[model samples]
Target: MSVTKDVAALAQPVIEGLNMDLIDTEYIKEGSKWVLRLYIDKDGGVGLDDCQLVSEALNDLLDGADIIKTPYTFEVSSPGLDRPLKTDKDFQRYKGDMVEVHLYAPINGSKLYTGTLHDRKDGMITIVCEEKEITFAEKDIAKINRAIIWN
Candidate 1:
């Protein structure tokens, strides 16, 4: 297994046992700190205690494991209200909902698209913005999240 995969594999069991799903994981460096951001979730929602429990358990495991050699900060938290959608399945689940998408490349002279998520099937998303139907490649989305519109 790849080193990153190996680390994630070792960490998955512990996360699952705590009744949390790993929404996302990032092993990155921020200036002097290597931050391990573990975005976790549950069925209804995630709370403070959920994050605390996972943080404590993961810390204990990390302390015992020799997987990471650099000084890093471990952050365990909910994906939040505006959770970033990273997969076609994510778009599928939130289909019929509104969303904001940022693309790696401009589509029809626009890199940002915001509209009602009208479609999510066969690995593509159709967002209706201002009576115009804009299609985006599932892979080209750099960042996508459920849009919070208070209306």
Candidate 2:
């Protein structure tokens, strides 16, 4: 099995046991070191205690299984506030909120757009900036970060 799959199989139980969702996992070889990154989340948010719980459990599992077969670093973290806006559900939830997006292909004259997400329907995103509404195709979006609004 692939390292990612193997890690998921082992990590899922640890996450589920704590009543958390395993958002994502990545096993990467950077230079001579292998890095295992685990992204976890819960209903409202994630805290240090949650991370520690998962980390401790995952460490025990890794040590016991010896599956990695090499020295590596394990990192468990939350996706954070400015998490990537990937899915349609993400866009829908944050509609009317301000966001910053980077697109692979330049739209009009720029690749980065920061404005209010006027609406999102189907696979189209309409952003209202200044006085104009700019439309974007979902596939063209490279990365999107939610903009924090403070009253």
Candidates in order have lDDT scores of: 0.80, 0.83
Candidate of highest TM-score: 1
- Itemize residue pairs with steric clashes in candidate 1: none
Q: What is the C-alpha lDDT profile of model 1 across 79-139, one tens digit per residue?
A: 8888887655566667777899899999789888899889876767789998888888888
Tens digits of per-residue lDDT, candidate 2, 1-151, equal 9888888888898798898878788889899988999988776679989999899888988888877888899999998788876656566667777898789988788999989888877777788888789888878988877877679
Estimate the overall C-alpha local distance difference test score of candidate 2: 0.83
Off by over 4 Å in 1: 1-4, 130-133
Candidate 2: C-alpha RMSD to true structure equals 3.3
Quote each prediction's TM-score.
0.75, 0.71
Residue 118: error of model 1 in Å? 3.4
TM-score, predicted candidate 1 vs. hidden true structure:
0.75
